[model samples]
Target: MDKIRRWVQEGGTLITLKNASEWAIKQGIVKEKLLIPANGGWADTTATRAASTAPASEGKKTKETASASTPGSRRTDFVNQEHEGTRAIAGSIYRTDVDLTNPIAFGLTDRRLYVFRNGTTFLRPSRNPYATVAQYTATPLVSGYVSKANLKQISNSAAIVVSKVGAGRVVLFADDPNFRHYWHGTARLFTNALLLGPLLNLPEGPATISAEEE
Candidate 1:
């Protein structure tokens, strides 16, 4: 913790696991750890794969190399980003009841995903590519090449709604059923995902879930 404290004090805001490891040396978190780049180890793999259950065009396959690296990005022990944005890292009540039924489901591998973001009040970043605030939750679904599986079914077809939200071209896939469940605490873990629907929704397919946008 001390090494981490020094890194934070030294203007190290954004970081990855490797970066954290390096910072540990200065702050004594790890006692002389070296700074090494994280290959594809931290990038979100679930976001780009077709998986066995959900397949799609929009959710195309973006191949990930175990050692490949991208620019302006870092690897965290958390979501394991491919780049700067949250492609699909998730949080939730438990591991099994994850939120994969939603497109964000892939991150948890068809499980109950959750969000570690701020909450309903704040807005998204100024130059945000997505429509939601920086606080919403998600699990990476799919990306890359010719994928047509996006037209497939989510976990619970009837219990949720996958469509665009707001006018800014954001496609938010939300659920109305969890409103009561999240509050109950004992309610299903995924119930929070449904309750969070209205708040964390993002843009769905304007372009083909298969075609790449320039």
Candidate 2:
């Protein structure tokens, strides 16, 4: 970890895909946050069944019941296993807004890009507005299957983030830019990270130094 940190500090461009980006956030290598669902909304059949079958008490509501009954709390219906599995993106295409002015998006003729996603991972745009090179559109799903819940969460989320670590830079991609070697649309993003990452420069401020230098 220390070696990788030093390398990046000295001027290495680290490009991470999918889980690698999560790992980088966990290791404190980057100052970015993952886009997690409100309550981790995983299906809990056993708990749901237990709560449903439990006898109603005269007083003192159970914690789960109270939470469910609380005002403004989100209520989610229990879905079957097969139906709930759609939360994980099997394979989908989403529309992203690319910053044409940024060097990381250079050579991309279009301001809009269609990217391939096959996982549930999502990234929050950096606090530094300029660091986000690309972001998902308000209604990002272009094609393929994605759960309605996921679609709500993915709306207007960061697709690509670039942060400078000392003289080096780190690029985080929420999904694989090159999937199965057939997604030519987003392949340019991968190439841009390799060729132009070192040249990325953000506004001169403390936000740019939020990664490791702080």
Candidate 3:
């Protein structure tokens, strides 16, 4: 982890997704942790079952009690990221809300994208200043069946975050844009990241320290 951190600090670009992003945060390569919190939404069975069958007395349980203690009952939060496991939101179509003016959004005439077996990811970056070039128009549904009604959108969450790390750059993708061979529409977005990430002159943030500084 330390070696990787040094590499990133020395102007090496890092493009990470899902578990890799989560691991980077934990290792201090990135400062913020992103997690899909345990809730009734998506494929969280514990949250669903608890909400459906638990009595009023169980509702009054302490935070410690509600805390993730079992495999099925574990919270999907970043702290329990490895616990709840990744979900595949099969056959879901997402609209990409893009900053068309941004260079990273080049060649994108349409905002629609498709996903197959897409995982559930909720990102909240607290330690770095990043520009959101694109985001899902709606909260991503993480199950075999995609349903718009299952999502509860929050204004601050994003699907992509681009930031400068030292002299290089880092791009964090909450979910896989290219899910399978059939979801070829999102390949352009991924290509944009590859071509534009290093070119991005991101605003200064805690993670933007110069390579010569330390």
Candidate 4:
């Protein structure tokens, strides 16, 4: 780990995708946060099913009794576990807004690109606005199926983020850019990370830069 950190500090570019990006964040190799779903990851099917199958009359009585007996007991809901499972973004296409001005986006003519997304690994945009080279649009789902809950969570999330680590760089992608060799649009972005990684620059100072200054 120390060697890897040193290499990055000494002008080595480290590119990570999907689960690798998540691992990097966990290892403190990059300063970023994962965008957790509101329900806290996947649904608990067993718990939900148990709650859903209880007698309605008994549930009502229990709730009333609990409310009267315990002043601050949390209320539980009977949710459709099947519906909750739909929140997983199995495989889909989403539109991302690219910062054409950024070197990572060089050779990209369009400001908008469609990318394949197959998992729920969402990334919060960097505090440094300049570091976020690409971000999902307010209405990112371009095609394919995604639950409303998942779509809401993915909206405005970071699709590609690049940060300067000492003299080197670290690029993180929320989804596989080179997925199945069919997503040519995003494949270019992946290539850019390898070819133009050294060109990525951040303002010298705090990690975050306000949009107003730009």
- Top of the candidates by TM-score: 2
The global C-alpha lDDT for each of the candidates, from Candidate 1 onward, is: 0.27, 0.79, 0.57, 0.79
lDDT by residue for model 4 over 75-100, one digit each (tens)?
A: 55667446666767789999889999
Residue 71 CA error for candidate 4 (Å)? 24
Residues 82-144 of candidate 1 have per-residue lDDT tens digits of 532333213222111333444333233333333221111111111222322111222222322
Q: Write the per-residue lDDT of candidate 2 for residues 11-118, one digit (tens) a residue.
A: 999999998887787676776777654454422122333454457772236766667766558656666446667667899888999999888787888888889999
Tens digits of per-residue lDDT for model 3, 40-89? 44221224333544677766574457564544674466775553233334
Off by over 4 Å in 2: 38-80, 204-214
How does each model score on TM-score? 0.18, 0.75, 0.61, 0.74
Candidate 2 minimal-lDDT segment of 10 residues: 41-50
Per-model tally of clashing residue pairs: 31, 0, 0, 0
The regions of model 3 sitting more than 4 angstroms off are 38-88, 111-117, 125-130, 138-144, 147-150, 153-156, 205-214
